[model samples]
Target: MRIAVTGGAGFIGSNFVAFFCKNHPTDEIVNIDKMTYAANPMTLEFLEIYENHKFFKIDICNFDEMENILNGCDVVVHFAAETHVDRSLQNAEDFLTTDVLGTFRILEIVKKSKSLKKYIHISTDEVYGSIEAGSFTENSPLNPTNPYAASKAAADLLVLSYLKCYRIPAIIVRFTNNFGPFQHPEKFIPLAITNAMENKKIPLYGDGTQVRDWLFVQDTCRAIEVIIDRGKTGEIYNVSAHQERQNKQVLFKILSLLGKDENLIVQVPDRVAHDRRYSLSCEKIQELGFEPVFNFEKGIEVTVKWYERNQQWWKTVKDKDEFKKYYKNRYPGL
Candidate 1:
């Protein structure tokens, strides 16, 4: 099978690319990444020697370019998006352009491709907004709060529209918070781990009481693999580990694992419109024979070790001028 993975250089995307390339040696894999600040090429550098793996630096928003590359692909795994919530608040336009427009462009191309079998759109649980009572199922009404979530929600609706209007064989997978290696340091898990390792103050937004369901990146990728192979077309699946924890509790766990102190955490003003809690009901994906292999504790240990051993990987990114500017502007005292 020939599959095209968009945003293959980013965290989850890169992990999926590496996993797919290794497991499907006979399959042709095309990785198209825009190389955004969050996308690091080094994540997929190990795949350089693979004859069946090819990398293309193309934005999904570019129709002709995306169409040319997506022509004969058997499947399109859409993982490209501007996913940072804080960054989205700072600049919502980029999110709209990349997430909504990008997905639309990919849908248009996939609609026209005769060889395409399925299009899996990777989405986030945030599109369901803050769920206080219970986990959000695939049938939950979309109530996106932040600009990032709004953009993804728009894209998700667009994909479903194509499925209904054009009969495109598309499936949407909405996953909870993902934590693992290769994630940009700006994210919660990596940020907390790196900060605690460096003995720097880990900034906590608000009282850090916000709760989120965590899914290990590998488990998420495995779930996606199952969905791609067995999921019903035009269906939406919620992939989650059902592991829920408050932001402060997660910070303490990271600190304890790193032999650091909880006092290292500093409360910061919360981002505007921050969701208080989020959880996802994975019954849909579970019914399809998908189960999470990585438990929360095991996943945390593995993730911490990855950051500890791969200091050089994040060091370069942390030292970049752009990253510095973002840190200076966002956290101020960091």
Candidate 2:
């Protein structure tokens, strides 16, 4: 299989790429990334040693460039987006431009290509807003609360439209909160872990009771592989680890693993239009043989050890002016 992955330098994208390269050496994987502030090319540095892997530093909105690059690919996994909810609350135009317009362009190219097999759109459960009780099925109506979730919801609808109108071989995969190694420090888990590592206080929003089902990046990659091979066209699948944790609970786990003091957690203002909880039904994907293999306790332990060992990977990044500005701007009262 020839796979083209957008946002391949980002957290989950890199994880998928790495797993594909190691497990399926015979298949070719080409990655396209805009190399945004949240993305570090170094995360995908291992691609340098893999002959089957090729990477291009290009934005998804560049349709002409992406059209040529994605030609003849069997699958196109779209992951490129401005994904930070806090950052989106500050400036949402980039989110619309990158998430909406980018998807439109990618869809146009995929629709016109004869050799393309399936388009896997990576979406989020935030599209369903807060589900206080029952798990949201794939048919649940979208009710996005924040700009970031709204943008993703829009893109998800666009992908479905193409599948419906043009009969494109496309599937949307909505994943719950994902955390693992190589995640950008701007994300919640990485931010908490890294801050705790430096003996600095980790920021917790409001009462830190926002509930999100956590999915390990590796498990997500595995499900994507299953979808790539067995997923039905014009369908949507929910992938999760069934490990739901409150934001504060996740922080406590990280602190416990690192032997850090409980006082390191500082409560801050919550997100504007914050969703109280997001739970998804993963039955559809399970029918396709997708079950999360990693337990959150064990996965998080491995993730903490990774940050502890990978000082060079993120220390310089955290010290940069960009990182400082982002931290000051995003975390209130820091």
Candidate 3:
């Protein structure tokens, strides 16, 4: 099989590429990434050794380039997007351009492709906004609270439109929060792990009570593989591990794993329009023989150990001037 993966250098995308290449050595993988700040080539350094894997540094918004690269691909997995909520809140234009327009470009290419058999649109549970009481099913109406989620919701609707109007073979999978190796330091899990490792203060938003379901990235890769092979077209699948944790709880776990003091935590102002909780129903994907391999406890442990052993990796990202500036601007006195 010939597969094209967008954002293949980003966290979840990179992990998926490695996982797929290992499981399907004979399959050809064309990795497309814009090489944004959140993506480091080092994350995919080992993939260069894979004879069947190729990398292309191209933005998905470039229609001509995307069309040419994805021409004969049997599968196009769309994972490219400006995905940081905080960054989106600060400047929404990037998110809108990359998440919505970039996805449109990919869909356009898929609509014209005769060899494309499957177009997988990776979505997020944040599109459902927040659920204080119960979990959101695949059919739940999208109610995005932030600009990032709104952009993704728009892209999701666009993918579905192509499936209905142009008969494009597409599937959407909304995954819960994913954490593991190679995640950017700006993100919650990696930030906490790295900061605690550096003996720096861990920044917490508001009271740190916001709830999120944490799915291991490898488990996410497995779920995506299952969906690619067994899922039906024109369908949306909610993939989650049901291992929900409060922000403070996750931080505490990280501290425990790293033997750090709780006093290192410093609460910052709450994010604008921050959702209090996010939960998803995984029944749809589970029906397709998908199961999560890592619970939060095990995943968090593994993630902490990875960060501990790979200090040079996250440190390089944290040491960048761009990251320092963003961190200072976002946290101020923290």
Candidate 4:
């Protein structure tokens, strides 16, 4: 099989690529990424030893380039997007351009592909907005609260439309919060983990009670594999580990793991239109025989240890001027 993965240099995508390469060494893997600030070559450095894996630094928005590269690929996993809610709140143009328009470009190319067997569009649970009670099923209506979630929701609809109008073999996978290795330091888990390593104050937004379902990155990768192997076309699968944690709880856990004082936390203003909670009923995907291997406790411990051992990796990312500039602007006092 020849698999083409977009945004494979980023956190979840890189982990998926690594997982796939390890499991199926003989299958040809083509990784496409825009090499954004969140994407680092070092994340994929280990793949250099794999002969069947290839990398292309290409923007998905460039329709011509995407069309040419995606030709003859058997499978396409679309993971490329402007995903940070805080960044999207600052300026929505990048989010709309990359998440919506870029996805449109990929769908255009995909609808024309004769060799493509599957096109998996990765979405997020944030698209359903927040729920005070009850988990959202795949049938729940999209109620995006932030610009980032709105953009992904638009892309999800576009993919579904193409599946019906153009008869493309496509499916959408809505994932909850995923945290593990190679995640940018700006993200919650990584930020807390790295911040504590330096004994720097970790920023907590507005009392830090927002709830989110956490999934291990590897478990997400496994869910993708199941979808590729047996999932039906033109369907939406909500993949979650059923691990719910509050923002403060997650930070406290990280602090406990690192033996750091809770005083290292700095309360900050909440994000614009921040959703209070995001929960998904994974019964749909579960029916496909997909189950997460890592619970929050085990997953978080593994993640903390990863940041501990991979000091150089996170350090290199944090040392970049882009990261520094963004950090200073996002949290001025911190």
Clash totals in order: 0, 0, 0, 0
The residue ranges of model 3 lying beyond 4 angstroms of the native Cα positions read none
lDDT of 4 at 226: 97
Q: For all the candidates, what are their Cα RMSDs to the real structure? A: 1.0, 0.9, 0.8, 0.8
Residue-level lDDT tens digits of model 3 in 1-334: 9999999999999999999999999999999999999898688785777788999999999999999999889998889999999999999999999999999999998898999999999999999999998999999999999999999999999998898899899999999999999999999999999888889999999999999999999999999999889999999999999988999999999999888899999999999999999999888898999999898898999999998888888888889999999999998976
lDDT (Cα atoms) of all candidates against the true structure: 0.91, 0.91, 0.93, 0.93
Q: On a 0 to 100 scale, what is the lDDT of residue 106 in model 4?
A: 94
Off by over 4 Å in 2: none
TM-scores of the models, in the given order?
0.98, 0.98, 0.99, 0.98
> Mind giving the per-residue lDDT tens digits that candidate 1 earns over 204-289?
99999999999999998899889888999999999889899999999989999999988999999998988999988888788889
